[model samples]
Target chain A: MKAVLGNMRAELVGAGGVVERNAYLTKRYIWWDVAWFVWTVANTLTIVFIAKGIEATGGSLDVNETMTTLLIGAVVWAYLGILFEFLMETVAWERWEGTIEYTFMAPLSRAMHLAGQGVFAIAYGLVRAIFLFCVCAFVFFSLSIPDAKYFPAFVVLVVASISFIGIGMMMSVLPLISPEKGTQLGFVAQGTLLVVSGVYYPVSVLPEWMQWIAKVSPATYALDGIRKAILEGQGLSALWSDLWPLLLIGFVSIPLGLWVFQRGEQYAKRHGKLKRSG
Target chain B: MTNIQQAAIEALPRRTAPAVDVRDLSKEFRRRDRKLGRFAHRKRVALDGVSFTMQRGETVAILGQNGSGKSTLVRLLSTLLLPDGGSAEIFGHDVVRDARAVRRLVNRVSVEASFFKKMSSSENLGYASRYYGMTSRQTRDLIPQILGRVGFPPDRRDEPMESLSRGMQQKVALARALLTSPVVLLLDEPTTGLDPRSKLEVQEFIREIRSSHDSTILLCTHDLAEAETLAERVGILDRGQLLAVEPADALRRRFGATTLEEAFFAATGRAFEADDEEDDEDREVFA
Candidate 1:
């Protein structure tokens, strides 16, 4: 028992190392992060303004309702996007720094190392997503809904992050196994997720085949659950349909993602793929 | 042998096990080979059935030309690269089966002083300490002490790694390796590009580590003088094979030569200056 506790303590400290090191790296690259933040805001605003654009075209509709739906889609997509990019970039950043060998050679377990990256990504993503939410929903648009259930929306967001992280962890191995075109492949995966997740529209509007794909995407349920929470004032018990799928995907995907990553890491080590960064 | 003879054999002063035991370890990498606009792949043997052993508290240097499988050997033992054949053991722990135990005991300093360039040296070392399972409080005091011992300036500990000279970066690399218990130090061409002053400084620090820390050191270098002076045993590696491993003076005497450079030529039938091009860090690698 003492040995097990000691090992656990060591793993936790190692995970904290990953978080602290990344925080320092982010501090040095603060300006680049700020620039990316600005671009994220601009892109989200462009999507949200479609409702205003429709009103300008002489369409008779409930402007506030339309804006509220678009806003939820935009902000949640941005939130999901943050987690995706952060996790995917984990591999890219390690390769770019040319420290893949050192990081892999560390005494820490692979699970703990990845957990550190995941924890950091979730924290950082939440910060950016919340900021984007405030800037868009309250500041830029001044939109509000009566009887909104913020707590349930927050719960849905937390659960969805797990599934998102699992997918991201699977993507993280690409760069390790293929140094040349791994990042471009990650972008392709992200684009596919975006199309199938109903980020900017309802899943019912997508083609029947794409709707099938959306059923597997965590973002689909996350977006639906949060929208219902905010727009319909639904509580946790009422959101069971969306919550269970998210939970199922989270539990299954996390372990599968971890297994796939371990195999890819072993492949990298055997092929000398870990040595190449450029 | 009788029971009393067996008891006497066991009582004889003998090391229980070698600090590092490598048996027929080999690694092969596939490289892309293009002929007449057709791309094919070829398997390149980086380390070919190479074997050696290191005693505890011994400092050994491997002398090799470029692309001579030195770095590949180090990487394999460090657990960064998987071997294709045979096995290795560190302090009775198999590298493949007990890699965690090996990782805890070995630290490597490669040719390239790799780090997060934007982060300070202190931050980088602090990060490494945590990965080695050192607590924050331990690293808070240990990082500076190790950094200072390597002749690093205290004022520049907070400066970004990219801002420092290659020599300074090398010092930081050495410091990071020594941050843990000095069990086994793998120095892969550690002073390759350093100026003379920095080279001497690093060499002096290595000597200090051996004498004070009782650490087993594996120094791989192309510099003949550095190998002869800093190492207790100098090994000659050519192509993918270890030609010889013995004390420097004895190696020269065995080859009937004056200097280690001449001894290398006498043994391999090639000038020490000529290097193999088949196996190198920058060679084309394929999955």
Candidate 2:
């Protein structure tokens, strides 16, 4: 029992150290962080403005209602975007810094290292998403959800992050084995999720095949739950339909992600791809 | 306290164990056989049944040209790469099965030693120390002291690693390896690309490390003089095979050559200066 406790304590300390190191790196590359922030804000604005543009051009739609829906989509998309970027770029950043070998060779288990990254990504992504949401809300003053149950919406978003992190963990292996196209492929994976998850349009509007894809995506439920909680002011009991799926996916994905990454790591070592840089 | 002193204080009870032991170790890499109609594959042997052992506190150097599997051996022993066949142990801990234990015991310094480029030398060392489970209190004073001992200029310790010269970066690498006071140090051409003065300084530091600590060193290098100067045993590895491992004078006498370079030629039937870069072109690609 004492030995197990000691081991657990070591793992926690090791994971914390990885988080601390990443925080230092983030501080060192403050410009990249700033640039990403600006890009996300611009991206959110671009989508939200389309609704405004429709209003300006005298479209037949209900302008205020349409704008509010678009604002929700924009805010949700911004949150998911940061989440995906943080998770997917985990290995790419290590490669860029040339610390992949050292990091891998450290005594810490793979579980601890990746869990550290996942935790950092979620924390950092939440902060960035909140900032983007605030800035967008300020710019689009008329964007308001009539009954905003923010607590449940926030819970859904947090739950959704677990699945996204698992997916990100899986994607990180792409770079570990193939330094050339792994990172680009990660973004491609994110783009596919975006198209299917109804980040802008309702899932019903998507093609039948895309709706099927969305059925498996935790982000789909996340978006649906958040929209209901905010747009309809639904309580936790009302959001159970979306919550269960998110929970299931989160439980499944974290372990699957870790397994896939471990296999990729072993394959990379065998093929001498771990330290290969283009 | 200096790392040497710290190592002694925290040292585990010594046993009658060799620092490293290997038996019939082999590694094969698959490469694309472009010459065989572009889709064919072949196995390129990196290490072929290589076997050796090092007693504790001994310094052994493996001399090999590029592509001669020095790095592969280091990677295998360091538990970064698993062997295709055979087994290796660090102080009785199997490298593959007990990788975590082996990792705690061995530290590697390579020419390709990587750092968080955005972080300063001190930060990099601090990160490594923490990973090795060093407390903040120990690292606060120990990191700068280690850097200083490695001949890194105190003023330059805080500069971004990207801005530092390769020589300075190599110093930081050495400092990181020493930070944990590893029992086995695997050096894979640690001074390959440094200037002569920097190379000498690193070599001197390696000598000091051997003398000051109860650590075994395995240095892999192409520099013949370096192998002769620092290591008690100089090994000649050629084309994935270890030809001989002996003292420099014994190697020269066994090959009936006047110098270590000639001894290398006598054993390998190739000039020591020959470029082996083209050898990689025929490697087998694993799908």
Candidate 3:
């Protein structure tokens, strides 16, 4: 038992090293981080403004409710976007820095390396998402959710991140095996999730086929649960329908992501693609 | 041999095992044949049935022109690329079956020594130390010590790696490799692009490392002088095959030539300076 615990502690420290390296890179490239933050804020506000535009154009819908819905969608989408980008960029960043060979050659397990990346992405994405939400709320002073159940929504978002990370892990391999189009393909996967997960609209309003895609998407439950808790003041028990599906997907995706990534890594090594630069 | 004697030999300490043992190792790359106009594939042999061994604390240099399979041989031993056939063992650990153990024993320094360009040399070294499972207390002092030994300028250690010259960067690469004191060091043209002064400094460091550390060194280089000066036994690799591995004087005497260059020409029937054009057609696919 002691040996097992010691092994776990060692692995955690190894993973922590990966996170530390990323933090150093982030600090060195502060401009890129700032630029990404600014872009995210602009994207959120643009989506929120569409609701205001509808009201200004004399649409029949309740403008306040529509704005609240739009705000939730925008904020949630930003969180997911950050999560996906960080996770997918895990491999791409290593390739760009030309450290992929050194990093892979290290005497650390792949699981710990990826776990470190996942932990950092989740933490960084959460902080950025919260900041973006605050900025959007302050800019649109009229926006309010009087009965917003913040705790349940936060919990749901955290749970949803697990599945998103798993998906991101799977997407990261695209760049590992194929540097040329892998990163762009990761974005395409994220975009597909965006369209199906009903980021700006209700899933019911989607075409029948896409709605089926939404059914399998962990993001769908995340959005649905967050919207319910904030807009309808739903409790944990009431949001169990969304929570369980998220957990199931989380359980399945994490292992599947790791497996696929391992396979991709093996392929990359076999084909001498680990260090290729275009 | 008697059964008792065989058992006794098997019971001997593994520390006596050769630091490196390669047997019939081979690697082939697939490339598009432009002569066949695009879709036609060709198998280009990188390393062909090459076999060699190095004792502990010995340095062996493999000399070859560009694309002569020196890099491929180093890559195979380091577990960076899978062999198309045969096996390589580091301290009796198989490169393929026991890769994790081999990784713990081997450290590679290549011509293209990659670093996080945005991070400082100190940070990069610190990160590597941690990955190698060194405690923070050990790294705090050890990183600076290693950098100083490699002759990296102390004042510029904290500057971003991108701001440093290529020679300075190469020094950091050497420092990173030595931090863990790996049992096997595979250097693939480590001083390829350095200035003459820097190259001499690096070569001097390589010599110092072999004396100071109980490690085996496999250095692959195209510089005949570097090969002759640093390694005990110099190997000539041509067209993916090792023609001869012997001391510089021995090789010259065997070919009845006064210089190592003439000896190489006599062995391979090609000038040592001639480029292998087949390398241009070699293509790699990531997928």
Q: Which number leads on DockQ?
A: 1
Q: Candidate 1, residues B165-230: lDDT per residue as tens digits?
A: 999999999998888764778999999999999999999998988887757899999999999999
lDDT of each residue in B1-287, candidate 3, tens digit only: 22322332343237777888888988887656789877897787888899988887789999887778887788788788898899998878888888876776778899987999989999999877677666677678888888999999899989999999999999999988888777789998999999999999999999998787766899999898999999999999987889888988999999999988999999988898876454533421211
State candidate 2's TM-score: 0.93
The regions of model 3 sitting more than 4 angstroms off are A1-7, B1-13, B33-38, B276-287
What is the descending DockQ order?
Answer: 1, 3, 2
Q: Score candidate 2 by lDDT.
A: 0.82
Q: DockQ, in order, for the candidates?
A: 0.67, 0.54, 0.56
DockQ of 3: 0.56
Interface RMSD of each: 1.3, 2.0, 1.9
Pairs of residues clashing in candidate 2: B30-B284, B30-B285, B31-B283, B31-B284, B31-B285, B32-B284, B32-B285
Scored by lDDT, the top model is 1
- Provide the clashing-pair count of each candidate structure: 0, 7, 0
Q: For every candidate, what share of the true interface contacts is present?
A: 0.75, 0.49, 0.59
Of candidate 2 chain A, the 10-residue stretch with the lowest lDDT total is: A137-146
- Docking level of model 3: medium
TM-score of chain B of each: 0.90, 0.92, 0.90
Q: Which stretches of candidate 2 lie over 4 Å from their true place?
A: A57-60, A140-142, B1-14, B280-287
